[model samples]
Target chain A: MTTYSLPLSKRKRAVKTRPPRDALFIAAACALGLIVLVAVAAAVIPFAGDPARIVGPRLSPPSAAYPFGTDALGRSVLARLLEGTRTTLVLSTLAVVCTAVISVILGLVAGYAGGWAREVIMRLSDVLYSFPSIVLAILIAAVVGPGQAAVLSSIVLVTVPLMTRMVSAAAMSVAKRDFVTTAKISGVSAPVILFRHLLPNVSGTIAVQGTYALSVGILVEGGLSFLGYGVQPPRSSLGLLIQEGGSYMLQAPWLLFAPAAVLVVAILSINLIGDTMRDRLDPRETRSLV
Target chain B: MMSASHPDTDTAPVLELREVSVAFTSGAGAKRRTVRAMNAVTLEVAPGETLGLVGESGSGKTTTASVALGLKRPDSGEVLLLGEPFTRSRRANAGKLQAVLQHPHWSLNPRRKVGESVREPLTVARRDLSRSEQRQRVTEMLEQVGLNPAFAERYPHELSGGQRQRVSVARALVTEPRFIVFDEAVSALDVAVQMQILALIRELQAEHRFGALFISHDLGAVERVADRVAVLFRGDLVETASTEEFFRNPQHPYSQTLLEAL
Candidate 1:
């Protein structure tokens, strides 16, 4: 029994180049983290200043005492923005989490089970997908009535179809692989195969899609709130704050600028993160990134 | 080593395919087409015997293996494992049958550690074994496949093609299945690695005494590992013979042509 060694050129050698650092990814992650932290802090700390409290003269411009100045109701713009951050973040996060959970389960079942299950799930999602997302969200929010639940459900409904589609595609490909068949041959139960084998393979897709869903969810929440079907008056969401600020945009631009700036930054950060994650998670994209 | 003539007439075959046929339909309506993938192909593997199935591409070799592994339900006929009827729905006979597919990259889950993949069969079928005992068996099985026990902690991507194939074998054999299918298991590796794997398969088969359906297009590989040879052509089982006799004087024209190409 003799061993044969390949020629130097034929043998595979590891390429040890370090991956290039992505400055945009780092910046976006940090910004998103900071926004989340501020939201969390506003929620947990009792002394984070009342966003609803009347502070200074109504419609005051930016001053030393008040960074973001006062809104039409004399509420501290900065404080309202922070509180709005909490509301928007919480609602969107909840919706995105629900979307992820529900979509992943549905996607795995549809992809792995195939046959009629695939047809039913995919066709249902297709029907939901046919409507303009905003219109669908508005209809649901209108029917459910203006509140946090309406906004949450609207975002969940709007975002779920796309996320489920992404996950379903990933899971379908993974399900076709030999490892999945091997798991089946080994007698692992359907649930175990779905979770243990199928889920992990499609998780990268889920994570990447989740970031996009989060951004979309925030936008939907804002759209719903802006139209008066989301978080109601007195309790400020970014969308509601922006809607209020819109009327006084000519007199004091900061009223609109303050919340709109935060909203833009939040959405940008999430989108950038999603893009970077897509590159990192996909093997084909990793080469170009490096 | 078991001789080619050693008959196990006293015991039931570890695996038997009784006139198995499979047809796949594609498209819809008037344009629909049905392709007969397997045409009532019947074969048998005595306990501890290595039956090599050789064929060209699209010769239904994979379909035959799929039926034997119970991955595809034959449109007609039955598959028996350890003298019991085996079907796609029979969960009771899960670990009794297993397979080593061609591409090791797809055969093992990329996310799971080698040990976890190898331990899955025991955990699923041999639930009586304790966790530690199962882990111990995984370690032993890795060694049996010529892998270091430490390889268990590593993911599939960390290993070379040959090493991954070895892990695939370890995962397949960990349950000590009554019968196993090797569907072009060594076709993906380099020549040296292919020989090594073939040798390992023979050695493992000797120790475990499990029947094997070794499917490959490589005649040289088939001759090396398989005690008996079966040739398939266009969804039909054209010839079956002892490995020595088949290589010496092939009866079928297709078998002779296959040998000529080699």
Candidate 2:
């Protein structure tokens, strides 16, 4: 018989070799915090300059006066990048909030009801989930027409299916638990059981999925804007900046480099935080290693 | 060793399962197979009586409990709660029929306070009572189960296994239910804890005068609390007799085997 065992000294050494999980979580939080600070500063402070105004010579390299150089329009790249951060964050947050509300409701109903209602709702979501996310977003954006509203609608359409599926799965598992049945036996109303007993248990799943949806929403917004179907010109978005920067890639790579770097960091931070929350919120994951 | 006070035979049975049968079909097409979980099993619990159902695992003990609790619908036969057809209106039987499951953690919501759990049945069944009244009843129920009333504020995870079992009993009794199913209720506890809980169940049953279906595989536990013992084997009810008669002269070979194992 194989009895799994590990020496205490070896376990201790293994833990010592790597930074604690909490350290990585804190680092990611701080990185996202810095991005938010910059976005807010650009929105509130006049000193950050107008992102759309021509403030320097076109395609200028990084200089003391123009920290991230200038874009093809002779606009300050740093200012445009900060402004793009604010737009991306705000749009993605709004889209995710909408997705959370719609998906959580649908998921709970499908999971708890478990009959023809489940079949209808799950089948509808299945049809939505069949298409690739970006392709679906593009289709929705095309129908909606190019603008912030189009991008917002596209993000919600693309993200809602996955979020709804996740919440439904979580709710189904919780509904099968004995407490839900206990509540039923106690004569608690159906709505009360759904909201009180079922919802709180699945809230961890909602929080975790919300973070992933936020990241996906940001990426969808960037993709839509890059294709000229989102946030139109003069309104700086990280995608639009990168699209403009692509043309002057050889002459000045800073425009693409600056916005792309910030987007990557923001998504990475959110993903790390989501992972940490999953580990912390789930009681099963917190059990001591044998 | 039977108690002198017998169950009131004149009144209608508090709960009854008449020829109840349940079968589960799994898979589909050529692969389909049906498993008979319970085969026309009949039993009854009069007011203030405990009917012990002893069977090995997979012998339909749980299916019987499920049918009695109205959690599962029988393919054939009928269930009566307080002498009325159980399926007529579930709302009518809600708080009157409650259960304490094997695992306290399973029945008690981990996120809810003990008090809220005990008060839930009252909140549903006795809506006319004020919130303060419900709270007072909850406190009284907690104390009756041998726990401090203050323990009500704590979560299930904060209590020990035995204490959690006490909380489960408190939750079951809060509505002053006419019938409560103890499905392997004491089987999950330590031997010492089992005795304590069995005693608590007997004490509460005497005071409240409710009917009980005490299901377990442990013959010792059955002997301790059940007034009459029913034996099931392979979905078939083999024999039933009063506690003393069943222990002294088991009629069926399966019942004899079960006693020998004990």
Candidate 3:
């Protein structure tokens, strides 16, 4: 065969360009990375300051030795905050990971295997979605009897519905794309087409949705703990800290502020990271944003 | 090597569609309606011959292509590929048939690189080829279509429309299929790029001697690439003739009108 090119070489060279990266997006990603690293460190390393130790006077203000001040139990607020980050991050990550795994399977099945299977899966999802996630988590936690396992499972249950719905919708649209049909006509096997073509196309959407789910999972777990239905005494969850600190809000204030700040930071970082990913992954969103 | 070549002798046609019909039904009971998409469209692409199926937008050109590709099973008709009864399950002769669809941007998966897309058929159908052999074949096909081997690493979006079309051609021909359906493959391209793609397709078809069903609306494009041209108007094939005969002397009134319109 002859190698005859259309006089497109010059044009191709002319159009050699890169998509501009947003500074704000870069900053948010860096901040999120730093937050994740700190959380991982807190989870892995033993804290030098004893979170449960009564080392100082109660209701103390922030100081060099006890940064973030002391709680009602005269325990170091800094230590408790680190331990709480570990607890929150671990539970939220587990819940999000479980929700993602289950949702991906259900969503792909619902979207690709359209008809009675799709109808059943979607109806099940609808039943779960009808209830507010927090209320659903609380109800599940209440039923299972308060413990860490119960809290984790409840958050997973609460999140799976929304994640599945998003993934299914994304999969359906991706399934309709010409490449899917192209792959089909090439005599590619069904499983190969599904896992290779359909799954990869929808994965960006899944990642973005999963990040959003992580933020929600954290909030739900915190709410459950605050209500005395999650993470029983001595586990040192951020929500439990807030619960214990609520009564002495007027006096110390630092007790509530310490854990509250960490929780807010975690949620905010995840949301920001998720938004950045969505913008980058979906060209339509990026176009609209520009 | 297959008995499909040499149409001058009495051999089986590379592709044959006999009285194929497709109708879409809508609504129920009192509001029922049937839209006839294709009406007994009988056509054939001889071995090593290019048959251009030309028609307006709703003239059932795409429907004809779909039937040939086994994408949509016709309501009633006998379709044959390589002298075998064309079943919807095409796995028995997978890589022996292929297609180069329109919209190169959409035809190629966005998540995959060009090399993966080009070598997909071989990967799925030609399990005999080693990984290195497949890579070599991909690069060779890319070169044949006037693209660099480096293009293997680039995603579809990174390439120009013409370059992407080249990748599409490489993919279609990679399997060395005896029959290929090019559904308006160059229509989406600019005039210059269209000519280059047309030239490249004709060149490759000449080298491989594969029977081609080139579906397009462009009269000049069809005349340039097709050995025979079939005109469709409103779900029915109006006329078919050798390229010279059709151009010099159009018989049917619809064909005359279509030529005049062109």
Candidate 4:
């Protein structure tokens, strides 16, 4: 780069990989994107092979036509696997976004207001946090009856408290700043201050947390379905495939093995992407990138 | 630097803090201790005059300025701006007074443009200024602080410390207030830049005739610009006298030692 172009060149490099590449973040993004596309395609295109069809010869091993082979129900494992990808995508995504929205609002309000209001809100969060979310989800699932909506809603309820607590912590820190006081002194309304000044400053913190939520949400959905509380019956998910696969391990492991492999890859990818975003979003992270 | 640099010896007091005290409880649970930043310190700043509040580190000069600005309420005592009680009750009138804080890097929000920052207070007052009028005022104020108008669109990080401080001064001046509590506004800049800032402050103060509560630890620098000087020691107003009298014939032992240390 010439002397005149040096600063712009540095900025361009910073925009790409100013710091050395993190193999993990790239892999994670690619994996997550692939899984999401699988889910979206599942929702849109109707499969020619019936996921529930019991046509292929039972106990057939992996070959050219039957890649994932057949399950105990004699269903084409490959068809079920493709359809299950859609369920996993829908359940986890809805649960995470719903949890995030509720938590962010509560956190912002509790953190900024402080005093008696903060105490009440924080105490409420603590009380909710005492229960293990998986167990809480099971309990909620029982009340709502077994299905995808019940499973997702239960997971959302369990995860939101943690998200709210993180949001409030960041909000409270920024609320005490001189700029906030300066904003108030300037007579900007409370809502304007909350969304404009305080929110933008705390976005890096929230983006990091949201990534973690996506990873954990997938696991929670799997656990629910594995226990028979999630994605019931004709509906398929990675958790359902795993549950169904556990039965015929010795005879045909591929039925359960294929979906389980996808699940592990999906979770790993999400976590990597989350950590990468956390690094990138942090303003302090720029120093090393330089 | 002499105390007699100020020719306005008989200017009337425009701002006052009557035995103002500010205290806070630090830490949590049983480990907490009561911290007193300003302890019953009475002081005054004359109209169109500069009263230097000189103190060593942790002497609570900034705390006094905070209380005066209506940002922090004193545990006791009262702050009077222009002979009116300035407490939680008179918050609306607090706009007549403003502040220029220390650490130019932290003083302005980097995420915001300079135009929005400079036009902030006036917009808050619901001044129906057209965009052109606002632009004109921002330009004039920026120029008054020795900065070009084009600088208004840049982020705070893009500017040097001296330029940032100048931006902060423009922010305070854009409000067009009568009193400004300068709480270590120039402390973080280089000595050369500090002189430029001090001279600019003196020029602006004389031109606008705004009373200023100038806080600094440098008695030598204080002597150059202040009309009267108040020396603070361990949260107590050790001495308060006209700038010339305090430097020429100091009565308090702490004030005498403080003068000697300089």
Candidate 5:
């Protein structure tokens, strides 16, 4: 029994030196990496034939020559899917980055400068929060008209308030902490305290929220495009592809399956990655997996 | 009353708060009430002196320190740091003051390494010190506070409570400020650890000569370290005397009870 226990203890020690046993985290990370690689390739690389040109027979079934078959216009579904991936990623990423920057600034100002400024900023966010975000995005998109810019700004408008509220709450809690007061008492300038002390401490929350924003941005942009208010004609988006495929669902099932699969894959990967990052960044999450 | 231009201005108290009052409005509308946190509080700590401020919880000892530290502006009255008028709005004497607050766990930024925490004051107040000079001074200050130099590389959570408080001390002293407010600096530690910390504070004070306002509710602990003790009750200064005199023959009823309570 002693001999057997000795070897078992050694094995446990070996396990301790290995990376954490978080299967879900690993799977999500791989999925996210693959999706990002495809997005980057689609953005920079040209397909085998003109994505806009009719390069094959219409409604061709999935085969070696046409991996995802063909659509009604004889355009390769594979090429269009790639193009749509680029559109979805670039637009959503752009909107989320801008939203994150705006929200962080607004949050820091509202939190560090309490009193009338805080009251005004917080109330404004509350007003924005009262509106349904998707409905609000669509309303703004209609006013702005159809284009990538319209979709981007519409998403930013709806998402910025939510992100701002989150960041502001985090900033306010941190501001009340002793370290922040310590900084103020030491006579660290207001701007320095906001950036150096407040910002770094809240960065983990900001990052996790930013990741979640990417998923929201993609969903919002897709919803707008599906309703014919986003990406317009000539340009392609995942929602536009899915919409076009929806009409031919019975005749060409591959058209619906392919883009829908990518969309689901993209959104799921982003959410999972966000959750994993939140878990990893949290100081209290120390449960070792077997 | 001495003139502001007196020749001995340089020798004036390192920190002086005269009749400082602070009030806060709690609740809203019909239920609104103004809570007086401090009222007519007058105190001073001479250069190289340790003046202990003792009071019950909510008695406004911390409020007085806040005014002295320039963290909160007094509703009325004056604060002088190094004989210069001080307020939250004033920038002229900002970094000339420092503090080691209670709860060292919450005082230092957990995300920052201990070295950066120690060197923070220098980075903010003494930017003229070169990088190498700042690093050298941090190491020396850590040593003075009886902490290992290598402890600077560790995070605040990695250190024991006593070690973190010592790091707090090093951070407060790194700037070599004219005055510091130790707001219950030793109250949170174990009794044995508290003794070590008090000894280290005395040793450092002997070398640096920075006036300190030691605010604590622990009467026995205050007696060990304070040269002079001031008692506060319900936001008013009840008595101020040397530790020996106050303990020998207390004048105020509160002071007598405070001594007996110890």
Candidate 6:
């Protein structure tokens, strides 16, 4: 093969320097850490009103009296918010990661192997995707029972189809590159080629999709929790707190306002991270922007 | 008893293609159509001779090298190496046949150091050479190809176009493959790099005494290094002779036009 060497200056760094650790990663990681801290505090804050702590009239209004206002049981609104953050973080993270892991693995295997295998796996994904997202989650939740397991499973079922198809396409594209062909001709085993060439090349898709699945999982789990079919009471969630605050919309709108704002911030930040990651990972984005 | 510089070497062609034809499928889906990438073609190369396969793109120059190296299957042609056809040789015999491609940019894995890429042929052959032996071989191959041996630690991207191609050539030669395929291997290189690579190929051939099928679209290059030249047009064997004869007495209309173009 005819080979070209970059001059000492050019060759030393033809590898695009990895974009410095992404800002979105740092932001998302911080958000995740905050959620975990709140969850841990909810469970072991050693206070009677940490979500377990109950006081004031059931529907006390927001004031120095209750920063988030009292619920129906006069429990501290801030306590419920903290506890809700814990539940939301735990369930959404699990569901999102689970979907991403399962789908990306299946997609890489199917697309990289291709032929009959691709047809079978991709067909199954199509069938799974045909069901409406919430309805599918609801159906699984109904069977799995209206709790965290039910909610997470439902979301996973709904989200994996989208992720699998996207991952498969990305893996297929990477697998077919000239570099991958060279790897094959070098007598590298199929498995090594899959991991070394295919997966690393398409990790951009994985990161982009992971963030998306996470946001959707959070929103969906929150919606289910609000409907009283997720996380369970006493566990508390931003969704449940929002649902509770929603009923007394007039006396203490802050009850709804607090949870709704948190949800928006959480989803918007995650989405922003996903978008930024996609832009940074894909040189095409920079090209188009220029 | 593998023959080493045997007297019979002058008798049996080191590599031969008996009626090789390459058919390529074009279009997509239901519109798929098959075109003769190469028609019934036949040629042979004696050991230590550089037999050049010259053709335009899609004329099956690359395809010829591919089949000769067992990279592609011809629809109904025989690829004979060392007097025995490729089908007759054991697949493990692959170490005897190697190919160098044109796009040096994509030939080596970008992740690997040059030494690793060059040692790949031996690695593939399940060779038990010591690490030092392999390293020594790689260094010698690099220097032999007119590249700085210090490039051993470098990645493919670190080298210029000519340097990468030399690295690839070193990789192919590491195992001492008796038959080598050059699939338009020099066409993509800069003019100066092309001459250096061509000269390197000639020098390596003389040292290793291996037969080579040098595929290229450039006729000037063929005249420089090729002992014999075979002209292919639309996959048909248009002309085949010693480089001097082909240039002096152009028989085929396409060959005449191509010679005039260069």
Candidate 4, position B105, lDDT:
59
Candidate 5 residue runs with Cα over 4 Å from true position: A1-21, A43-49, A282-290, B1-10, B87-90
Q: Score the docking of each candidate (DockQ).
A: 0.47, 0.40, 0.40, 0.20, 0.28, 0.27
Can you write out model 3's per-residue Cα lDDT over A1-290, one digit (the tens) per residue?
A: 00112234543443345344466666767776776677567666755476778989988999887878988878888778777777877898898899999998889888877789889998998998899877898888878988788779988888888889888887776676557766777888777887888788777778898999888888987888889888876778888888878878999898888778878877887787787787666422322111
**B-chain TM-scores per prediction:** 0.94, 0.94, 0.94, 0.88, 0.93, 0.91
lDDT of 1 by residue, B1-262 (tens): 2223334464579888889888889999998998887888889998888999999988888889878877778899888877877754647886788888887667778888889999999888889999999999999899989999999999887889899999989888888887899988999789999999999999998887889999999999999999999999988899999999999999999999999999
* Residue B166 Cα positional deviation in candidate 6, in Å, after optimal superposition: 2.5
Give TM-scores for every candidate, taking all chains together and pairing residue i with residue i: 0.93, 0.92, 0.87, 0.86, 0.89, 0.82
lDDT of all predictions, in order shown? 0.86, 0.85, 0.82, 0.77, 0.81, 0.76
Better of 4 and 5 by lDDT: 5
Candidate order by TM-score, decreasing, is 1, 2, 5, 3, 4, 6
Off by over 4 Å in 4: A1-21, A47-60, A283-290, B1-14, B26-32, B86-91
- On TM-score, the stronger of 4 and 6 is 4
Q: Against the correct fold, how does model 6 do in TM-score? A: 0.82
Looking only at chain A, give the TM-score of model 5 against the true structure.
0.87
Model 2 interface CAPRI class: acceptable
**Pairs of residues clashing in candidate 1:** none
Q: Of models 4 and 6, which has the larger DockQ?
A: 6
Flag regions of model 3 displaced more than 4 Å. A1-27, A44-48, A112-117, A283-290, B1-10, B26-33
Superposition error at A36 for model 4 (Å): 1.6
TM-score, model 3 to reference: 0.87
Model 4 lDDT tens row, A180-215: 666665556677778876677667767777767777
What CAPRI-style quality would you assign to candidate 6? acceptable
Candidate 1 CAPRI-style tier: acceptable
lDDT by residue (tens digit), candidate 4, B155-221: 7778898998898888887766678878777777898998899999999897777799988887877
Candidate 2 lDDT at A127 equals 95
Positional deviation of residue A255's Cα in model 6 after best superposition, in angstroms? 3.0
RMSD of each: 4.8, 4.8, 5.2, 6.5, 7.4, 5.3
Give per-residue CA lDDT, model 2, range B52-85, as digits (tens).
9999988989888888888888999989888888
- Given candidate 5, what's the lDDT at residue A197? 75
Model 1 segments beyond 4 Å from truth? A1-21, A45-48, A283-290, B1-10
